[model samples]
Target: MDNYKFILSGGGTGGHIYPAIAIANELKKRYPNAEFLFVGAKDRMEMEKVPEAGYKIEGLWITGLQRKLTLKNLMFPFKLISSLLRARKIVSQFKPNAVIGTGGFASGPLLKIASGRKVPCLLQEQNSYAGVTNKLLKDAVAKICVAYDGMEKFFPAHKIVKTGNPVREDLIALTGNKKEALSFFELQENKQTLVVLGGSLGARRINKLIEKKIGFFKEAGLQIIWQCGKLYFEEYKKYNSDTVKVMAFINKMNYAYASADVIISRAGAGSVSELSIVGKPVVFIPSPNVAEDHQTKNAMALVNNNAAILVKEKDLDADFDTVFSGLIASKEKQEEISKNIKNMALPNATKDIVDQIEILLKK
Candidate 1:
């Protein structure tokens, strides 16, 4: 077998895809000749995103089972059987030295099959609370790389590796020159900057709350950089003003993180990782729609430590303005949150994860 022939599996959202890509990138740097393949759900974002990152990907006819009674749940058994068979075929063909899962619907089947074949496999759980897929495959995986603590409540203690989530390298080393970031966004440097992000697909509640309080932001002397996400961009783009910049996506995320004095964001694991490194005071509005309410758990991990503020999605309309205005008014609180969160940043997470991967592969 080759020293490093790796297969990565993850998808459904950028939260899963980006970390899979980050791990792939780190593996490539360490073993230049390493061959990498990605397995993702057929219609998910990773099919397109993996290729864009210069990796080959195979699609499996797999999806998450619905929570309630639906036609999709009726087909769950058939889909699971088909995905297992397909995943086995991919593993048999690739003959990988190791397989890595970043936690998504696709990763569940792919890693399960790989483990069944006696192949070394690792699973990265990005949330404070484990998803059903990861939990189901917990015993099969050789290692469980996790971002949050107290996860021993779910996985085998020996297999757990407490590596913080991997973030984009460019964002990790962000040198936030307020003047430069403001200039790039074409905003005046005199005003305090507030950056709002609602993940890649956008949050409906967050979008509505922002719309209702656009006047409040302007009144607070805050310049805004809002990423409305692709789904709502068309409808919300019209709200863009001289003081507020609206985008479907922001490619230069480093600048966005650097420019802002305060941030309002969803508390996904990837967002938390980036925010920790950026060291900015943030208000985390965890999406209630996510599986197991893990986003709230992620936010609470920081909030309990005084590293961030958590505002529930349901409370955004009523409490967002009051909570946000309080932070903007108090410089002391902002500085304290920023310093505490930065202390929690794991800057060498990629290196740490890669190190563990290499050790497992060697065995």
Candidate 2:
């Protein structure tokens, strides 16, 4: 029992993969003798990211079905069947103590197979709206760790544990002072800093909005830290100046979060969780392109609680100037929001999740 083996399956994006990695890391801390293995779709981000996180991962021959009719859509049945067979083989060979899934198509077959083999299964649903894989596997998993309220609409009340989402360890405790953070980014200490994040690929609409508002920000005497993503770096790089630091990515996010007077971000589950912990006043422009518009739902959960402000893509032109300007002008509003958002953060999320896994192991 001391040498417990756990299999974690989730991928396609960082939202899914990072949570799995975080949970695995926590499990490693609690049970140093435990064995951890990750299962993800072949050729997906998880294949590379999992190894980078120092864990072994196996790839399943699987991918999500496309909305429009295409060759990949037509091949869905073959892929699902192949993935299921391979997953069953993995379950049989590894004989995991428990299977943990973080909700992506890659997790579906693996969790299903592991549960069928009578292995204890747990799922971590990061978003307010459950993913298709998690929903389908809900009946199979012994417990479901969720981030938002009203998830009983998607999951069984008895199985659900409101543990929030696992965030990067570095973000949990921001040890750097604002002075240190500002120096790290080479920004002026006297100027208020506006940090913009649009995920790893760069959001087109967000990039455009930031570009359009550059003049307004400069007039307001705000320094900016813009992470425009790798895809849009070249096009936005010309705008970089002494006051505006534009980059493909920020390796030191703790510094960025510490240095921010305010934050403008996309409402990904991971980002929301991190921002809540960062406790900064934020404006969330949820991406409308995601499945079921879950990003909007994620943002609304905070907005409804007065923890953050949300401006939809369509309403940006009319609302952005007024909303952002008002928030910036009032330190009272900023403090109120910062306090509310920090209250919503579950700083012990990763540990809480591992506690559930320990319960399964004890059983």
lDDT of 2 by residue, 1-363 (tens): 578999999999999999999999888888889998899999999999999999999999999989999999999999999999999999999999999999889999999999988899999999999999999999998999999999999999999999999998888877869999999889999999999999989999999999999999999989999999999999999999999999999999999999999999999999999999999999999999999999999999999999999999999999999999999999999999999999999999999999999998888
TM-score of each: 0.96, 0.99
The parts of candidate 1 lying over 4 Å away from their true place are: 1-3
Instruction: Give one digit per residue, the lDDT tens place, for model 1 in 177-269.
Output: 878878999999889999999877888888998898899888999989999999999999998888999999998888898788999999999
lDDT for model 2 = 0.95
Task: List the global CA lDDT of all models.
Answer: 0.91, 0.95
Could you give the C-alpha RMSD of every candidate to the true structure, in order shown? 1.5, 0.8
Q: Could you give me the TM-score of model 1 versus the true structure?
A: 0.96
Please give the clash total of every predicted structure, in order: 0, 0
Give residue 291's error in model 1 in angstroms. Answer: 0.7
RMSD of 1: 1.5
